[model samples]
Target: MTSKKLQVIATDKAPAAIGPYSQAIKVGDLLFTSGQIPLDASGQLVEGGIEEQTHQVFRNLQAVLEEAGVTLNNVVKATVFMKDMNQFAIVNGIYSSYFGDHKPARSAVEVARLPKDVLVEIELIASTVVE
Candidate 1:
């Protein structure tokens, strides 16, 4: 058996990984992205409520996806974590706006806390081989 080399994806447009992890990883046609918080490229968490934070999270995800040569449209799966489930509507609205008509499989849950104590975080799995 042979091992397949995975490609590490990164971009200055997105916040640098906070720990020892790549922004995303690609193997073959699949790209797995790390959970993105509301931090900007400088690694400072954005201001405002869940709506604003959700938007920032999506922005970070977009940058990572673009770096991988994909977009939200190429995402096949997603995972969402929010500090409060009460923010679902706000987060969902922003999420729908970003994803548009392309709905990917998803799982969402309210977590007690998140990195940087941001209100929301999102991660995705996308296909780089867009058909």
Candidate 2:
């Protein structure tokens, strides 16, 4: 069996990965994006509460998705990590605004800590445009 080459997608709208990782990975027809914190395109965490941070996270995800030839509509699943589950309502409200039409399977959980101590982080699994 032949293996396909790994494709890396990078975007300026999202905070770049702090470690040795690409913003998103393309393997065949699937695109896997790394967890996105509330950092802006300039790689600085947005100064705000959970609400503003959530919005910035979505924007970052959007940039990565578009870079990989996909949109939020193509997302099949999402994993949302939060330092406090109590902020679910606020984050959900913002998340819903991004994908008003498509509803992807998602799981949200409270983590003890996140990189850079951001209030929220989101990662996604999406399907690429099938060639």
Q: What are the clashing pairs of model 1?
A: none
Please tell me which predicted candidate would have the highest TM-score against the true structure.
Answer: 1
lDDT of 2 by residue, 30-115 (tens): 89999999888888888889999998899999999988888999999999999999999999999999999889999999999999
Poorly placed runs, candidate 2 (over 4 Å) = none
Q: What overall lDDT, based on C-alpha atoms, would model 1 receive against the true structure?
A: 0.92
| lDDT, candidates in the order shown | 0.92, 0.91
Root-mean-square deviation of every model: 1.0, 1.4
TM-score of 2: 0.94
Runs of candidate 1 exceeding 4 Å displacement: 1-3
